[model samples]
Target chain A: MVTEQQDYAYNSKIEGEVVVSKADAVINWVRSHSVWPMPMGLACCAIELMGVGASKFDIARFGMEVMRFSPRQSDCMIVAGTVTYKMAQAVRRVYDQMAEPKWVVAMGACASTGGMYRSYATLQGVDRILPVDIYVSGCPPRPEALLDGMMRLQDKIKNEKSLYQMKKGREDPDHLPTGPR
Target chain B: MNFEEIFSELKRKEAKDCDSFICEGKDLVNTLEALKAKGYEMLIDLTAIDHGVEASPRFSTIYHLLSLGEKNYLRISVDCEAREEPVVPSVVEVFPAAEWHEREAFDMFGIKFENHPDMRRILMWDEYEHFPLRKDFPLAGIESEYPEQDVVERTDLKVKAAPMAGGPFVADTAGPMSQTEPMAKDQSWTESKPKKEA
Candidate 1:
């Protein structure tokens, strides 16, 4: 079969002919592979976030080394600590500015559900302000847990209706609530 | 001079606690001036305590002074005379650093520091209605919309009071001693009082 160029009846190699994939597959593949993260490192969990980016853990293996400070530049917002009532407005303002097709990773107990800080000053959870895609547990999760959450987020992205639907969902975010899933 | 010499110079009797001495509201400025001459250089901290709304001399403005030069400390306690609208003389003229401390005392205990350059609440915003540190204030905070009129105009940023959610919970008995010894213990509150289980 390898020697049969004239026969066309069948080599495993399709030399010069095009290979096809769904638009969903290609775009999601590209987007999932190169996720630019906005690190909202407000407290102790921020140390662990830095650890993920450091050489020992090497977040670059997933092609996510670029940590964008600006909300517009990043695709993922990793809220890594406590969200106080005073700070919720600022967080919402940044979330509003983040580009469409954005995803949020609520890292650690504090960012997810106020952890032990259930008080008047602390916002019970960040979901009070922004929609979260993944909730990674741990008081301050080890770097491995965050990486696993990232991969889970990637898996979620790969399964989306993709492209047009995501944009339409953003426009009518209320109607098509990107609620938990 | 040591605590004994300083007290003797000020014509004060020995306090039960040698480092601290009590003074009247009218004599606050005079005592502070005399202590400054005695070389207690810094007004380290000033705070006020509310004995009770009903108690005579309802507030006590406590000052912690340090002589950075002498390497010693002195505490001066002065009672605000009026029970209802307590006012104490400001010491900013003598210490300059007492400005913010006086503001903090006023903010927390409602003990007005008379002749303070700017008499406003230091911790709570200008429009905040309640003195949070008062005994009557609830453990769970009060709910209000934006504190500033300008902030209301700018955005619909609502800072809601934290929900109790059957929370500020009684001791989660399973947890270790470090976590749950002192739960939100009081039964009554001046604000949103927690409902009884029954």
Candidate 2:
């Protein structure tokens, strides 16, 4: 009977682990690359976020083209546009629903700092609600900027200590700050 | 019906702009009914104007009506007094489209649309205390505590300071084009030039 580990081991040998020498490194490499993004498009910046996934600046080049609308299926939340005060609750709910070891990318000046709308309705920044991992600054950032933000997130994921530490951080409330840090 | 016919029928004051009438709050629904009978089927827009704190009859609900059949447009203004709880007769009975518009007006200016089917806040959340668009409402917004954190306190430090006395657009010195001496010469050339035939 061929075990699951043996099957993967056989496949790894056949495929050749060129740079990913260790088991941990291979897992980290896969996790970093296969970051399924939850497109939380709120306003105008959503247009640029959509552009990043399009053919010209195809996000699939970095293996992040799988745009999942459901938070359960995604590992990253790309918050695109002005998160209004009215919509902040929904944003927090979506962020909370996302699976552990999740990352947030505040994609635009609006999502980062509410852009030029210093009005009553718009939320100041998304970071007040969710612990944002990356911030791409622009009124509405270009597709290239969004791609760069994704790559930065990938780098952060790559340098993560270990799966044990990540799981431990999720399980232990004391390990991580409860609210926005 | 044409603007003249509607004006004579409703006995409304002709607005400064052509094809517009200022209808009293009492005559609003009746005027809308008369206009609807005249084939003004589309409610183009419904908005309110804040006439400041001390102004009598503070809010004026502006309704733009369009007659697709006749390819004509009409603007109607209805005045409502600014009271602790200002009540205005809803035109929803005449036009079903006025439902959301009335709700929005209610949400922004705290104007109560009497007999509205669902008189709830349209734009702002239900829990939101103040009508944000009202003149009395602070431009920055009211202080409200969030479940996780105080949003006002968190954002206080992050708010960027406004530019110094003279903004970036303010010129330090007048350019040659901005100078009155050069502009006088250029004005004649622009004004004397014959209007281009469309």
Candidate 3:
């Protein structure tokens, strides 16, 4: 099984072609702006995540209203709760399902470090299974914080001319993710 | 243990090892038992943490131990170091109700008891990979199942079918008419979907 870090490091193999021109930047921008996220809520933070989607927070401003139920169609995965060892593999599989150029956002402390359940069951962070692009820090980050993280992600997207090309030197298909098999 | 007596005894013993009190996690289990021997048996609830931006030692478990006899309560706590394995002793043997409560602790916080008899996943399936209750556990949850039809359907139909038609009122559908149907035919009802006309 692919451990979380291995997915982001220098060894992940590139199975697809890289997008390497100015045009790629525009496409990436469109994709990033029109993000269709999968909100996989687990704990209390889920409530806040709902708030972000609620009329008050209105995540639709970022075009993430699709809130995909199937991982294959989502552009990014926003992990909003604690991830236990039992759930780690499943998270990885969902990450795998999303097509190329997919991103992951670790939304809260629990998604970042297993929050309060630092024991035998919970995985310290979702990063242990999937690559995280931006981290929104909070027990449950305020809706404003989530918006800021999205803006930062957009900034990151704007700067990159090619998502695949930027990821070039780090590709290694043969390398397996580093956690439990 | 009786809270009044324990408090008074604790004061007299001046247990130097015990200083300021902050109840937490599994420690509350032992503290409760020790208090119960003194007569404290009413447990209030479990409280937890979601340490964010505070720098490590992310979560804390709080247990409220109370006694109906003396009508007193004491708080106990255990700190789960960030990214560290948290383990505490079992109080299940002491309190029968603790069995389920401890399981909830395990299911949510991922805290493990030293000698839990059935130390398996309770809320998340055995195959499920995360302790969902932890503050840092991903919100998107683990990926394997997204509202699995079987699991969600079981409970959801009971709830959803109430307000509207096409609800999971399968038995209600056939009701008296189905009872008259042959026993072999009745077995088909167990299938989630209705049989298609050949």
Q: Which lDDT tens digits does candidate 2 get at residues B1-198?
A: 556564554445656664777777787788789888889989988888778787887888889999999898888887886555677889999999999999999999888988889999998778767887878875656556543344433332232221111212232245663352211222222213532335
Tell me the tens digit of each residue's lDDT in model 1 across A1-181: 5774476464546554665789999989998999999999999999999999999999999989999999999989999999876666677667767876789999998999877676656766787567799999987999999999999999998887787776787688655433322
Error of 1 at B33 (Å): 6.1
Please tell me the TM-score of chain A for candidate 3: 0.77
lDDT for each residue of candidate 2 in A1-181, tens digit (9 for 90 to 100)? 9856534344656677665466657667899999999999998889988889999999999999999999999989999999877788788778778877688999998899766655667777788778899999876888989999999998998887656666777788457533464
Provide TM-scores for the models: 0.72, 0.79, 0.44
Once model 1 is optimally superposed onto the true structure by TM-score, how far is the C-alpha of residue B145 displaced, in angstroms?
A: 2.0
Model 2 chain B: weakest 10-residue lDDT segment is: B160-169
Q: Write out the backbone clash pairs for model 2.
A: none
lDDT of 3 at B42: 64
| Alpha-carbon shift of residue A69 in model 1 (angstroms) | 2.4
By TM-score, highest first, what's the ranking?
Answer: 2, 1, 3
Best candidate per DockQ, number?
Answer: 1
Give model 3's clash tally.
57
lDDT of 3 by residue, A66-132 (tens): 7887988887789888875556556776776776667788898889866545344456677656668
